[model samples]
Target: MSDRDTRHKASMEKLKARVEEKIASANEQRGLIIVNTGNGKGKTTAAWGTVTRALGYGYKVGVVQFIKGLWECGERNRLEEDANLELAIMATGFTWDTQNRQADTDACQEVWKEAERMLADPETYLVVLDEITYMLKFGYLDIETVKQALENRPLEQTVIITGRNAHRELVAMADTVTEMQEVRHAFNNGLQARRGIDF
Candidate 1:
């Protein structure tokens, strides 16, 4: 082999050994609290990806959409058809569109009741709280109540929270936190949101 090729093979072998060692050492099996946040797109999309992945393993999933009301979402439509998945779209509309603070708060409370029931259930392996940060930021739901529900969930039930500007407490409590930084977006150039891509 060429000298450059030999060096590359050696480097890859070393990296592979390190990765295998780490994987072997990771023996713990428990639910994780994963957070996807930041001023960027794809937060809910990424969470849905995880939901589908878990479904592939025959896991039961529950989804609660906080601020996206009863809109037509492709993922929602597909996942709701699965016998193992339960979806709840609990919002009148976006906060700006609703313009009714009391009504929004009431709706959020009802959503939380459903979410808490899912959290308490051991059969549900994954729960996705899409756009929940908006509710927390707007004081529509109590942070302490949310935290308690999360902390008290079944040991093997994972939860995913997605939205921009996730609360600091939620960040600190998360097992894995991914921030989607916005480098560029089509919307900035005045392109309308595409059906399958944007939603």
Candidate 2:
């Protein structure tokens, strides 16, 4: 082999050894709190991907949508077809569209109740709180209350919270946090959101 190729192969072997060592040392099997947040798109999309993965393992999944209500979502439509999944789209619409603070707060509280129920259930393996940061950011849901629910959930019930500007407390509590940065988007050029791609 060439000198460059020999060096590359040795580096990859060392990296593989490190990865395998870490995997072997990780013995814990508890559920994780995963957060997907940023200004870019795909936070909800990533959470739904996890939902699909959990469902493939025969896990019972629950989804509660906080800021997107009554809108047509292709992921929701597809996920709902699975018998193992249960979804609740709770918001009337975005805060700007609803223009009713009291109504929005009331709706969020009701949706949170459903989320809490799923969190407490041991049978529910995964719970997706889609766009939940908006409710927390708007002060419609108490952060402490939400934190407590997540903290006290079943040992194997994983929770995914998705939205932009996730609160500091939630970020601190998350076991896995992913921030999607937007470099460029098609909408910036006045291109409207496409049906399947954007929604």
Candidate 3:
């Protein structure tokens, strides 16, 4: 065998040998904050998948959608009916679309307060801050408040933040950071969002 092949084989053997010993000594890892950031679709959808999976495990999930107002995200419609989830929506729509900066900030603060409540609630195992980057982007909400809320959230609670351009500090603090790179998009071809696919 080549020297590189022999070295790779030896490394694999070492890794295999250590796995059993590590598993025997491992303790339950603490709950974490997961951030999904990028300029692509599916960030919120991916988080919704996590929300559903966590619900299946009987976890109490809280969802606070920051920029998207009362619009229908089918997941929210369905999940809100389930007793395992708490859903809060920022009924003021997007900043540019809404055309009222002060009103948008007020709406953001209202939803943010609810998010803060969920962060404090020990019963909530997972909290999804959907599209919250827009809140920070528009200055509707302070980023430090959001950061402190996440940092000091009930140690048992896992928070998931999803959006494009998540703050650098927030990404640094998150236990897991997933950045979805957009290679191709149907939107480029003038395709609009479809129900059950985009909301």
Q: Give the TM-score of candidate 3.
A: 0.87
TM-score: model 1 vs. ground truth:
0.97
Name the lDDT value of residue 51 in candidate 3: 97
- lDDT for each residue of candidate 2 in 71-182, tens digit (9 for 90 to 100): 7788888778899999877858788888999999999999899999999999999999999999999999999999999999999989999999999999999999999999
Model 1, runs deviating above 4 Å: none
- Please report, in order, the local distance difference test score of every candidate based on alpha carbons: 0.92, 0.92, 0.89
lDDT of 1 at 82: 91
Model 1 poorest ten-residue lDDT run: 69-78
Comparison by TM-score, 1 against 3, better one: 1
Q: Report the lDDT tens digits of candidate 3 across residue range 1-199.
A: 9999999999999998899789988777777989999988789899999999999999999999877757778887777788989988898876668899988888889989999999999999999999998889878888889988987888889999999999888898998999999998898889997888787
How many clashes in each candidate?
Answer: 0, 0, 0
Q: Whole-model lDDT, candidate 1? A: 0.92
In candidate 3, stretches whose alpha carbon ends up further than 4 angstroms from where it belongs are 1-28
> How would you encode candidate 1's per-residue C-alpha lDDT over 1-199 as one tens digit per residue?
9999999999999999999999999999999999999998999999999999999899999999988857668887777889999887776868888899999999999988999999999999999999999999999988899899999999999999999999999999999999999999999999999988877
